[model samples]
Target chain A: MTNKRVYNFSAGPSQLPLEVLETARDQMLNYEGSGMSVMEMSHRSSTYQKIFDDTKATLKRLMNIPDNYKILFLHGGATQQFGAVALNLMDKGRADYVVTGNFSKKAAQEAAKFGDVHIAYDGKDNNYTHIPTQDELDIRDDIDYVHICQNNTIYGTEWNYVPDTKGAPLVADMSSDILSRPVDVSRYGVIYAGAQKNMGIAGLGVVIIREDLIKPHKENIQVLAEYDTMADKDSMYNTPPAYAIYVLGLVLKWVEKQGGLEEMEKRNIKKAALLQDYLDQSDFYIYETEKGSRSRMNVAFKTPNKDLDAKFVKESIEAGMTNLKGHRAVGGIRASIYNAMPYEGVEYLLQFMKKFEEENR
Target chain B: MTNKRVYNFSAGPSQLPLEVLETARDQMLNYEGSGMSVMEMSHRSSTYQKIFDDTKATLKRLMNIPDNYKILFLHGGATQQFGAVALNLMDKGRADYVVTGNFSKKAAQEAAKFGDVHIAYDGKDNNYTHIPTQDELDIRDDIDYVHICQNNTIYGTEWNYVPDTKGAPLVADMSSDILSRPVDVSRYGVIYAGAQKNMGIAGLGVVIIREDLIKPHKENIQVLAEYDTMADKDSMYNTPPAYAIYVLGLVLKWVEKQGGLEEMEKRNIKKAALLQDYLDQSDFYIYETEKGSRSRMNVAFKTPNKDLDAKFVKESIEAGMTNLKGHRAVGGIRASIYNAMPYEGVEYLLQFMKKFEEENR
Candidate 1:
């Protein structure tokens, strides 16, 4: 039935597992005999609260999140969290940011709204080709938190190691890389992510924050902006993205069935390497990203000739590949091999690339 | 196929037209020829962008929205907008709020986070049984905007008339009643709805603001909180709730097929009146709300005996009439007849109510 399905490579709002999609489709008509789609279920209803709680519990167990962290399913996406983290956390004074790419820089800019945002290091000169080493981080005592975009989706770079923020708390925007790999949740004060790429669908952001971090502060902050408002009411403080959270639960279960984050990571590594190794060896294709900084989830590449790059993206779509076109900022091609991408998907792309290279050459 | 389908009457996230649900189900596995769920499509892609554009266009044409208004499909629920509206507007340091019921009062409290909020009138003294009159309003020149929750879902009351804002730029939180009736876009400065009620689903909020209202804001505000940022980028500021928006587009299209908002209002009236008239005439039932202020969207009522209310709710579920229990604050039986609630569904509820009252008596 899915033979007509192409290997969708769109960044962020990318592919979900076929299993997740089917489950959602099945539930879309009448979820568990409720005689209504989950879309039509009240967030305040017990049925939806069960789904919400189960989703949080599954994510916690899968990630091995510590008891100290409170999982919050929030709206307004990750970019909104960039500002929210600053509003909620940067109460003391300054915050530090290691700018690796576009999103990180935006995070720093948003954080700067509340207080001083010191750019500890910047990789803009190198076109955000690599993640800065931990030694390069400038942690200060006055800094409330040190923020990092763990993975640069647009630039195709990943931070393989977490940065030590001295005694200060560490915060990471793991939107692209979340759930694809295991992490020591204790290492960060907050690990927030947009659930579209690896987890579920668009519209909702999952925020994992240390319980102590969700304290009362500035009265000027919006009510819904307060973590307590959501925490106290179990994300039903407002109408939650019930459908998004439902689909996320399905994806989280899919990840567990695929042997948890560790196994998914290993599979993702092999899938990424299959395409990366081929691109590295080919003269027709170029992967100019720094070796250590390459993202296992997203691989951006280009041809030596610009017109050939355009031709490759166009022809690739015709040959059962979709969303292979890179972000307009760095126009070339980007293959986002998220956890949902089957290893065979990379193989499909590799064959397409080789055939196109031979014909063009 | 729908023989087993129960009538859902949850306040928000209530009921959707079966046609819309079926269309969404058929397209769940694949959207158009994209070979992936709409959830998987990148918000930036031309494919999803088309969906977004068509949604906005459909809503605008259906509402007869003037060119002066910018319709924003934003993240966060109506609750989030309570704060966002204050941050984006309330520039002059104060906004007047008429405390009609729970949601409007919450909106006033959230707005107060940014600026001073003057309670023009409070309906709590009467348990929000009726909306405060415009003559009771104390709109001041210093007020940035006068806010009102047009329809009270819990209290089962709706403002039968728009408040004379005295040129303070009227802003209405039209969450429950939006799209069930025609709204004169030019009557108010801004009209925002949570979309779960009458529009589509949860996880998305729609704001129709006069174009001039999308102005530059304070540097301290979050980018997504800024209306200009969304209006300039067509609400793709942060990937949006694309799936939610897609579903919303479907709902909007469904509304259009039902002969637009005018026809929807007529149908909703009949649906609400069917239940209300029966309840009003029944010796076992009590419709305590003021006749003039009653909501066509939500009708809250009660029986002479408290235990009977519980018994009726319990039995109604067995008979496939679910979610009929009223909001705890309004503790009795509440029937929310949004546009999606067919007259037959209300008929089923009426039969159940009559049978329950007879047996209990």
Candidate 2:
């Protein structure tokens, strides 16, 4: 099969590393000479057990996860986690949320169904273009857990630093920017990422949670929604998404080969800077994101008019660039330079932008 | 990659059709000149939407699903349905369950947490060797739904006929033998199948639910777990398992090419008869299951001793027959020939069993 010639820039369910795709393709039919597609292998089989274990271990090594944290591979994306977190953690009283993006807002709204949810900070006033500063947050001391989205995929913004929640555990939905940079995994109570973006696929979500938070799960929570039961069973309390997990293991191996999180951060920084610099140089297109809070993963921008923006996306697609159409809520072009997007793809975009700017100006 | 010279008979995730694997391999990187892997495409993208629609439509056609039943491609496997079924339907009062295999027992156990659950019948006394007879059942008239496993993969037993549930809705977990035979789908209020068996992969579960059953979602149900909400959104409420769904589409197409479920049933019957005939003819192997209730999907047999059973499994593995080990609870050998297992694979297994019997005798 021929490699994808065009670059994909959709926020999540974005691109994957070429090597990861190649390895996955090579092993599609017979993983490790098992004579079965990874999809066909039993989750309890020794072959899949190794794949599952290695994937989790590699994630731990890459993220420097502490011993107290249990990493779980779960189904139903981060959207499902909204209810799970609320169901599991919001027993004492209320939970605090820092709404930064469309997803975070949805999470906060969903949690409201279970308990009293307080919005500690919200970027809605700024049209979600900026992440809230530390001083702007209004976290409550009595809250169960503080929730936040680490990276705002739609608005082109990300948290530069983790919030200090004092005694309360901090839970972050890092759906887009996970493994793109290194972090102190021990500091956060829970960190979750849908595999579509920095990881591999869309079906599986990985959750790294401190053991203490899961202990409360014994108190009348639904069995299917309980983290403790799922974690204890090694995510095999039920039949898991075996193929997704296999592809994730391959992606993790590829991440390790690419020098882990440090190397990814460096490459991601360079790619973001290259594209942002070109956008800054041209006045024809304006970036919707705040200068200080721009996301390295998703870069949202807009032209002077909607028609122009549509033309830009169309012409860019013709020029071997796809999925640059911005989100509907934020009408513009978003160049999501995820870990898999090669720098050359961004360079091509820059060239196209320069030519378009020269002709329009 | 060299194919492992072994025939896998694990219930599920079971063997995949060789042709499906080949087609998937050929289109892994670029799907239909889209310049993107099916994994990379957006769920809402026209290319992927078509695949999604075609898969659902094909499955409906193959199963004879009525327009009133909405087919949803969901994550979290059938285990999630254990809770979802109760949350969606048990609002009226209680549910009737027939405990047969490990999965059904677990499902009944989970459903008990939500509302009043009545075990209409159980096969545990018979070591799950026989399906619950109509005379043995004690279904409640006030029950919201009657739940059963159509085929118990672990014990190699299948329901020879569907239960007459009077007026109550019939819900069956057809995870093990979903597409292997044609059924009157309109008769059941809900039928769910985890994709690993007759469908495609492990990440997605197909739920064919009657529209009326979904309308009465109780208050305070998690949005993700709410059947009505999911069905309303057409299963794209969140980023789905894109790659898994794509593979399911391929498998559905493969099923169509192989002459649909009617043809599949014919092949399954022939294959199952071959293995069962060999077992019935030999004194060295004892078919523990009742003669009339043997599953076409899984065929379980035992030897005189545990050590002999162990030897049989070991020798079978060496002879390129794999995963023939039965469930740990029932110490024996089980050959699971799902929809993907060709008639020739079962023929080889029967020949091997005959030779082993001769040598052991």
Candidate 3:
């Protein structure tokens, strides 16, 4: 209905690259002469298998994933995987968690159901605005794995460096920031991301796990929860989110065309800096999180006046800038600048911010 | 790719209504003036909530779902629900299963992992050619629930009537046959289907559970498996398969435009009958399933000789009639004609069958 496109800044199911959406739109009915939508194609079909294979390969290329690592396109969001991660990895009946924000807290809570989960570090005293230093972590080698959420979507904090797991395997929930930067695949045992942020649509979770980690756990009741079963089937143990995977393939292709992860990181840094730099200079606004730990994906800030913050959000929407309101968990204003968010969108927000601040002040 | 849309008839992840696909393509980038792809919109957004609400309402209307029945858009596919169903319903630690075909047998097998599962009736000994009569099912009030797969997609048989559970609630897996017909919602405790078959696409499973069946069992650990928790969140317990649910909405709208489920059933029956009538008249094609139990959604058959079956499958694909090969479990051919398959597609296959049979015979 609206002719003009808005700059979407919500976390998780946030903005996607327009080019990727266009590609998906073009292939909606007939995918590469298959004469069907990806949703309509059988997972067993060669057409879909190619889509599946190419997607995995593209992801591998973008992330520089090692051959020892298997990329799985599993059906279910990150929350479902919280249980699966524990069921599969917590073979010792104990795991350590570094709680950075909401997602890490949920991961720890879900893991508690399957194993003896220990919070190695908690940032709650700082309101999850900073990642803990290695000295602060009491990671035990006896624990099966050390879990952390690399980027906190809600709190606008990120671990700039991979935490030292003290010989325990590291598992990260990279849900909100998977392809936003380059990562050393060899550094972690498992990296899982729900495909709603900086990936594709919702529903599918991409779990990139080292082959050695896929284990046979007799304690696990559900067959789908068994990582070995899914790994062997190439995540086709059952029907997958075919269309989501296909769209993800398109997004991956888009990422590769945008010069892969290095280029993505560079662009992300620039985008984040453009907004963060402005906020730093504006006495009227505040970016409370530690500057070193600030996320390049999401920037949360607050105006000195609550009424101005409300007015800013309202007026921004009218000017076709949407989802600028911060999450209710920690609210003021948050602008998520995912890879898909163009520089021009940030400028659009900047223009509104300047005009709104001047008029309101 | 191809200008002419080839008829897609693979099992699940099968054909979607063209109207739904067209509507989706049209709105792929901008959804209803929101100025963002539905895929890009957050699950927490008011726009997506409206989509979620309207979709559930449309489904309730099409299915004539009772007020007490809560429809859920769950993350995992039907296979995932197999464990959830057993975990939730098998409160007494035992359940009875009527194994009609592959899916039902799998369900029974999975339920065994959670609790005691007894297969009261099995059709596989007879090549899954017929549904057992009510007397054949050893239904008892002692069991927690009686389970049935209403339609056998692979074996080409269907339960013509709901079996009396003898006071215990009935659970039905209607994956391949949902929306192909209508049923009284009050008869079953839980009815779930993977979206790929008669619904829109893969990744999401739609579960309609009666409120009273949402139990209070402390033993069930995974909060995602808890139906009440998901139903309470409106399937936003975490970010759902948002795009898949959006497509489901478009599909429901298409079904409504086609005069609702009654009209859908009528069209499906007519389409099924066209292929069935032709097969019955042809001596070369073997319709093995008992006529009384034949499915109006899937038609499975074979030629007199295995070599002829091979030839027909190979030549048919060249002629654009694909996925006709039988499941490896059953060596023959299967044509799944869900609600999306147009009458013309079946007629096209009929023409091929007529010509192929005449020439081969």
**Whose DockQ is greatest here?**
3
- TM-scores for the candidates: 0.98, 0.98, 0.98
TM-score of chain B of each: 0.97, 0.97, 0.98
Give the docking tier of candidate 3. medium
Give lDDT tens digits, candidate 3, residues A1-361. 4776789998879899999888888888888787788878999999999999999999998999999998888988788789899989877899999999988999999899888999999999999888888899988778899999999988899899998887889999999889999999899999999988989889889999999998885543676777888898888888988889988999999999989999999999988988889888887787888988899999999888778789889988889988989889887999999989998898888888788777866
Chain B TM-score of candidate number 1: 0.97
Off by over 4 Å in 1: A1-3, B1-3
lDDT of 2 at B260: 95
lDDT of residue A87 for candidate 2? 86
Q: Write the per-residue lDDT of candidate 3 for residues B1-361, one digit (tens) a residue.
A: 4766788878888898988888888888898789998989988888999998999999999999999999999977799889889988877988999999999998998899888888889886798998999888887569889999999989998988988988888999999999888899899999999998888889989999999988874443676787878878888778889988998999899889999888988998899899899888888899988988999989999999899999999988878877889888887888989888999999999899989988999
Model 2 per-residue lDDT tens digits across residues B122-169: 888888888877888998887899999899988998888989886899
Off by over 4 Å in 2: A1-4, A216-221, B1-5
**Where in model 3 is the C-alpha error above 4 Å?**
B217-220
What's the DockQ of model 2?
0.60
| lDDT (CA) per prediction | 0.87, 0.85, 0.88
lDDT by residue for model 2 (A154-186), tens = 889999888888679999999999989999988
